[model samples]
Target: MGILDGMTPKKLIIWILLAIGIGIVLFILMLYLTLKTKTTSLERITPYKESLKRELVTLRPVHIFELMEPTKSNYTYAMSDTNQYYFQVLESETGADIPLTKLKDSIPAGATIYFEKAVNYTNGVSGSSTPRFFGTISYKEKKYPIEFVWGRYTYKSHPENLRPGFTMDLAPWNNRVDTTIYYLPRGSF
Candidate 1:
């Protein structure tokens, strides 16, 4: 009581206002730091999220060629007669027929062919229909099934030549004139 009696009312009011002002400033600074931390954390996670989205949307072509138990040496001679091998190209999603004449010379034996056309995918949607090759390779009066599917990963071996937006040809020929295209089957990552 004795100390309060000496202090003026105006001085007490000023002291109270100054204390409130300091408290307000500290509160605002704390809020700003919290927001900045949250923003930094959001920025850090954005790239990883985008990468995951790309991986989900990106499609890898499926190219599988299984050489039979008894691999035929003279595959070209065996398939000399066009009638021996039945080739049908179909659209994967629609099952529509693609003309065989268009793909005839393009898929030569032992050639790693790349399609001029690029497959476009937008937001996980594929721009072009996948091409499915269904055919039988007959040798010694025995028909062996040879199916080449190009679109999306389904097998363990992912060829380096194959990419998300390109169609790749993996034809293993015994009598290939081109020495550069011949490669032993080693699984790709």
Candidate 2:
């Protein structure tokens, strides 16, 4: 009664309403100004884009005769598991033999490779006849397991069973067929 003695209830309510409206307006203006001054870049907006980009294309463990993308097959790379940077997935092939000389320096550090193949070897005692491949890839803490099968006993071979066998074309440079396809590991393993 002391402060409102001269003011009617209706007038006091009106003043309160006016103050709230002004506060709202001020808040909106401040927010707009702050937003306008801030710079939002693509990278800044999507910081997770780089790390999760590779996970978007999940390399399934099981597939049915899937062909590697032509463009990607040449470059052969995969995105990082937790970073924006990209890493190369080197494609090393063997002609029933060991693959191209692996260049440790060529591959980026912190990168890992899992490679396996099964060839229908000439015979178990001899070598691979028809190759089937199986592999598991691990990036950071994640793993990608894939299996490629040719026939029976095409992909799975005991780790202790060291019989290196493979069949591959050396890019098939000419029209004439090249017979340097089969690969047999050296030494009596």
Candidate 3:
């Protein structure tokens, strides 16, 4: 009698239900409008999602044959013959000759070496540097394009006795190949 003297409980419940229904409809309408505006604005310019689609491919694992020490340095570089990928693994502590036995597989003398730094793609229209292999993967072949990047050592040499000499140390060369491939995606963008 104090709060609902004239109105029945059923009538009060009906009014509350109607208010909830109206609120729900308004919320849905607001959501739709917001989505429409967002989509329209996005259509006016280039979409970032669509602009960056190219990705980096993984570097395949190949055997490195011979390791090279850059002139007047202790850094070491790995070599392969069939594949044109040369890689400098780590800085040499003493800057001496890296033994072939220290490598994951024995790099035989006169074995082919391949090393590549990076893959490059140029934008034809803009003449700009497109994302590509900006790093090196080296192999030993008869002839290779050896571009000397200023202020940077293209190869690195590692210490001998890298955790029990070449038994199951797939971590050294294979891991580096994975890392090099990991950067491939950034090259596209």
- Which TM-score value belongs to model 1? 0.21
User: Between prediction 1 and prediction 3, which has the larger TM-score?
Assistant: 1
**What are the per-residue Cα lDDT tens digits for candidate 1 across 53-164?**
1111112222223322211222211111121111222212123263222222212233222211211122212222232233344323334333333233222345565533
Tell me each candidate's TM-score: 0.21, 0.20, 0.20
Q: Pairing residues by index, what is the TM-score of model 3?
A: 0.20
Candidate 2, 1-189: lDDT as tens digits: 498889988999999999999999999987665444221112211211222213222222211112233112322322222111111222222121653322221212333334332222233243333332334444466454432222222122446755533323211111232333223322111
Order the candidates by lDDT, highest first — what do you get? 2, 3, 1
For residues 78-169, what per-residue lDDT tens digits would candidate 3 score against the true structure? 32222332234222322447443133342333322222333233333442322211123334543322222111112222345222111111
* Model 3 weakest 10-residue run by lDDT: 37-46
Q: Give all candidates' CA lDDT scores.
A: 0.30, 0.32, 0.31
lDDT (Cα) of model 1: 0.30
| Evaluation by lDDT, superior candidate among 1 and 2 | 2
Superposed model 3: Cα runs more than 4 Å off: 1-3, 37-189
